[model samples]
Target: MATLDIKLKKANKVYKEGELVKGVICVDAGRSEIAHQGITLIMDGSVNLQLSAKSVGLFEAFYSSLKPLQLINYSLDIAKPGKLPSGRTEIPFEVPLKPKGNKELYETYHGVFVNIQYSLKAEMKRPLLAKDLQKSCEFIVEYSNKDAKEKALSKPVQFTISPETLTNVKEKQNVPKFKVKGKLETAVLCITKPLKGELVVEQCDTPIKSIEIQLVRVETCGCAEGYAKDATEIQNIQIADGNVCRGIPIPIFMIFPRLFTCPTLSTNNFKVDFEINIVIVFQDNHLVTENFPIKLTRF
Candidate 1:
């Protein structure tokens, strides 16, 4: 039996646009030499989108029209009609990281309905009556650091959530009075770092049961005919439980999960956005939420 594998030079398997993806293909044949017709290496990067369950019927036509947006496609012939020795053999390779014609390379993201991925596949064709060997591995792509200055100059966003400023309240008279103030360290967040902030409950007529921070992903997919948009919770973290103290600051900290998030992106075919929701649950089983739209960057 024979085995094949791919190993990237970078242990982290991360690269930016315009860099060279350096790697090697390893082949191991037990006790006998292996014969192959040809060996090829292929690299691909694409964005895949899917409609949520609720949007299935509404966008039947759009769903059928949905196709993977191929950003990069490159192939290399590493060996021609090669033969492997009895032991392990390694073949070095280097492929340029570039996007297709006029298209741009987006950061690799893994979402419920939208996904951007980059991978390398290697194939070894065998002669008659022998099974071929193949192997594949994924790599991460991040945006270049060109907006460092802009991110450094970003200002913190201060917000206040009170009953008077709340929206969509039909029975305002029945609602309890409350005032909460907070500031997001910065609206422009670095995806590789933790989100930082703090909040305080100035005053409240009713007792607080819990306070939580909910991270949501808003995805939109569609064409000129129509589009389907949905918001899904990626994670929920409770900062306070059975809250009793008032006038004390509560720190807000959250780490952006890899694969589940990327720099906020927008394209003609789809959009990937993120938001933070501050939820306050009252002891009486009532809840009030404050939402904040946030921008993510590689800087």
Candidate 2:
């Protein structure tokens, strides 16, 4: 009953690119001593795009091995070939979390058909006729530039867009034109910080029912040709349940999740983008929407 496990030195399993990741590999030979080859620790990071066999055409199937993708596999020696003495032993190792030659690394993300992952793996190389021990730990990696953040945040995101700009409201219909004004403290937002802003509605002919701020994510894959979008309401401030006049300013603020959400990023083959969508619903079932694109980063 041989087992292997990975433990990180930091409490949080988050790291930046070009940083050193330190951890320990715990190997336990339950109730018996074991003899085997050397132990190795691997740092593997890659962007994997998987295609179903049934969906592949004849030409694609013939050249399946040449699919476009990026991969990095770096191995470090942990111990020499020897026999294990006891029940449990710990080996400390540190490796740089960097791709070859200053290449940009996209934030870790897992999607339905596409995925970018970085993992720290440990393996016990046993001789032939025996199963080897293996363990893996996944971590999050974010790219950040303080200089870029400063430049992005130097100016506020101010825009006045009519809901009809990108809305489905019929122009022929007598739906009144609504104007939405948005102002954010900074155009650049930090992942661990809360986004603070105010939205004002004016020139509204219909009764305002609800105002909501939505966080939208756009995922692009396959050389920016294939894409998927998802949106969720992050902040909602009800002005009036039934009907109300305009001219009142509504406050909006939402904090991004510490985990499971990546910063805005772009790469050659994959990218993640974020935006703020302002929606105003009227009492007569009329909708006015505005999209304000913003930059999200970790600084």
Candidate 3:
């Protein structure tokens, strides 16, 4: 293989925080002749926010809540891609970055800090070489514009994992206890189809019904020994009604998808872990969160 090196006009340059930049990547091949060369550029950033709520009941002190927005990945881009020949070749690239969110949203607005950046990566072959070589470089970005908005919302939202908890009296009940005239394989809660509907609930009732609680998930991960069975269940606030029972309550949604159970957690290993999608249920058109505790303990 021959020797090779790359050169850039300006190793790095900063644009107005939200501005754009135009540049090219150059390759200089020495004794070695290049077979094929490709270039790629990437850019990214982050944003955060905090929220809170307070409400009261008939005559009692209500509830208060707070939440924080995690790091949000602004964006990732591949500016240019091309194959290069021997000798010196240049591949140009341009990137347009967006300004960070505003400062007013914070109880105390901390001037938003916009971080700009760029990266260059290339792969080339060696002259009559044994193996090809690759290299990369990254540059910084500066803020260009600051168009901050007061992130406002009047709706309630929560992100969480759901759980599946169907007490089957596993194994120990040796005999088929249910003396029903139907098929022995029939599941009491056969979710042939995911019941979809609105989830907006007004309030929860005293002794909720079986259909009141929505099953957020029935997920399973793999175990080291092999595929046995690993699952978790969760619950959340929702609307429910059955017979004379009514009000905002917990609802359980049964998700029995065609591929509900995976053969492996991930094809790479034979661990007992499998991927089970968490199905959601809606009450009065509003989606609910799996916010309760439901874990299984084996002897």
Candidate 4:
């Protein structure tokens, strides 16, 4: 029997556009030399999109033509037909990180309906009667430093949420009277850092049950005929569990989850965006929400 594995130069296996991805393919054969036909290494980067159940029937035509968008594809022959010596063997490989033709590379993101990934696969061709050996390893792609630096200069955003300022309220007379003020350190945030800010409850006629911050992912996928856009909750954090002090500020802090999140992206075939939701739940079970669209960078 034989075994195969891949090891990257960087322990984290993360890279940026235009960088070189270097790694080694390891093969272990018990005590006997293993026969092989040929060895090949392939690099692939793509974006896969799927329609949510809610939008199934609405985009039937679009779904039929949906396919994974290829950003990069490269293959190399690392070894010719040969037999591996007993024990262990390691073959080094280097592949350039570049997009195919005019296609642009997007940051690797793992979402419910959309996924962007990059991986390296090694294939070992075996004899006619022997089974072929295959191994795959995934790597992460991030935005360049230049893009991050440009977005870091954006100004901070301040906000105030009150019953009077609430929108889309059908029954305003039944709503509790309250005024909350807060400021986001910056609307343009770096994905590597935590989201920072603070909020204070100025006044409220009813007791509060909880105050929560919700991180949402907005994904849109489709063609010109129409696009199905969905906003799903990535995570929810309760900053205040009980009725908090009316004047004291409650610090707002949240860490962006890796893989589950990436720098906000938009393209012709699909789009990935993020938002923040401030939810105030009243002891009576009533709730009010304030939404804010945020931009994420890799700085």
- Residue 239, candidate 4: how far off, in angstroms? 0.8
Alpha-carbon deviation at 38 in model 3, angstroms: 3.7
Which of candidates 3 and 4 is the stronger one according to TM-score? 4
Q: Where does candidate 3 have its weakest 10-residue lDDT segment?
A: 178-187
What total of clashing residue pairs does each candidate reach? Answer: 0, 0, 44, 0
Instruction: Please state the error at residue 6 of candidate 3 in Å.
Output: 7.2
Best by the TM-score measure: 4
| Model 4 weakest lDDT span, ten residues long | 146-155
TM per model?
0.94, 0.75, 0.27, 0.95
State the lDDT of candidate 4 residue by residue for 204-257, as single tens digits: 889999999999999999988789999999999999988888999999999999
Task: Give the Cα lDDT of each candidate.
Answer: 0.90, 0.70, 0.31, 0.91
Task: Give the TM-score (vs. native) of candidate 4.
Answer: 0.95
Leading candidate by lDDT: 4
Order the numbered candidates by TM-score, best leading.
4, 1, 2, 3
| Candidate 1 residue lDDT tens string, 80-197 | 9967899899999999999999888888899988999999999999999999999999999988885232353366999999988778677888879899998999878888888899
Winner by lDDT between candidate 2 and candidate 1: 1
What order do you get sorting by lDDT, best first? 4, 1, 2, 3
Candidate 4 lDDT at 127 equals 94
Q: By TM-score, how accurate is candidate 3? A: 0.27
lDDT of 2 by residue, 1-299 (tens): 88899999988888887788998999988788888799999898877754434324432533344343555578998999998866998888999877756565667766533467889889899989879998999988776573233333545777685745655656635667777776888767877788887867767767777776777665544432333333434445443355544677677788776444566766665566777777777777766667777777766
lDDT score of model 4? 0.91
